[model samples]
Target: MPELPEVETARRGLEPHLTGRRVIEVRLRRSDLRWPIAHEVRELLPGQRIAAVDRRAKYLLLATAAGSALVHLGMSGALRFLDAGLKPAMHDHYDLLLEDGRLLRYSDPRRFGCLLWQGPGTLHPLLRRLGPEPLGPGFHGDHLWQLARGRTLAVKAFLMDQSIVVGVGNIYAAEALHAAGIDPRRSAGRVSRARYAMLAATVRDILSYAIERGGTTLRDFINPDGQPGYFEQELNVYGREGQPCRRCNARIQCVQLGGRSTFYCPRCQR
Candidate 1:
């Protein structure tokens, strides 16, 4: 699945083309994705001007006066900006035809992506209870420390919680924890404030770097420009089990924590 950085990459690529552009055509090649494509999307999007293109967690928000469109690029979804002359291929599911004769195309080989709608002054349930954005100012050490208090969950699991911090998925969580020199197996409540502070900063730095590099593309992820992100080349411990650690030269280790793969350097992270 596309995490926050990957999703943000898509948002950045789409924002320039989508903002202020009127939707002259609404073409739905299929009626469903993950869930049914809401009827409001078909009816409200066309002729409405796209006020802004924003991202909350991994969802892409297309805003207009009439309504807002919420898009989730499920596991294998990729959005492409195609010329009007280009034809839709096998997995191309949704298209937002702009007055500028461009198509914001959504293609998901797995059909897990979604198109939903929201009305004015209302928040979608999927987005309502999400924690603060990891890249936002609200997500510093003190914030994470407070939420981590009295939690017995492993630090990796706690960090992955949506209510504690949104969008630090498995890949970035492992990378951030590794960067902070914190063991993924530590109890969340037992982690010191100092370590948490370092962890938070590491998370921000890693995520920002990934976004700058256009996000890590392990599989099936591409920016809206159809370019694969190169951040995967910079991973430290996520997929390098048994490899030498970059910092300590210790063997990178792996284990299953909370059913997700966890990786770290035993000698470096304590």
Candidate 2:
């Protein structure tokens, strides 16, 4: 699944092509993606100008007067921008025809992604409870420390909680934990405030660096131009289980924590 940096990359890629453009047509190759693409989307989108492309957590929002179209790129989903004449592949499920003769297309091999709506001045239920974006002003070390208090979850699991700090998915969480010298298996409730502060800063730094590098490379994800992300090569842990740690040459280890693969350096992280 595309996480925060990946989704944010999509938002940035689409912003220029979408903002200020007229939605000349709304083309649906199918009626549903993950859930049924909202029925009102067809009624609301055509003829409306795209005001902006924004992101909340992992969802991409296409803002317009009618409402904002919220998109979640689940596993194996990609959004590509193309010239109007190009043909869509079999997985291409949605498109927004632009006045500039461009088309923003969505394709998902697994069809787990979503297309939903948020009416003006109201929040969508999908987005309402999301914690502050890790990259946003509301998130920081102390806030995370407060949330982790009394929680028995693994520190990594707590960090991955969307309600604690949005968008710190498995990959980034492992890397951030590794960077902060926090064992992924550490109990969230037992972590010191100073350590949580370091963890928070590490998350912000890793994610910011990821957005700059075009997001972690995933088999199903690509930039709007079809480019693969370059950040995977920079990862410290995530998929490097059984390999030597970059910092201390300690062998990296892996375990299942919170049902996601947890990677860390036993000697360096604790």
| RMSD to the hidden true structure, all candidates | 1.3, 1.1
Clashes of each: 0, 0
Q: In angstroms, give how far residue 115 of model 2 lies from its true place.
A: 0.4
Q: For model 1, what is the C-alpha lDDT against the true structure?
A: 0.92
User: Taking the tens digit of each residue's C-alpha lDDT, what string does model 1 give over 75-175?
Assistant: 88899988986888989998889899988999998888899999978899999889999899889998989999999999999999988889889999999
CA lDDT, every model vs. true structure: 0.92, 0.90
What is the lDDT, from 0 to 100, of the residue 183 in candidate 2? 92
Judging by TM-score against the true structure, name the best candidate: 2
Structural RMSD, model 2: 1.1
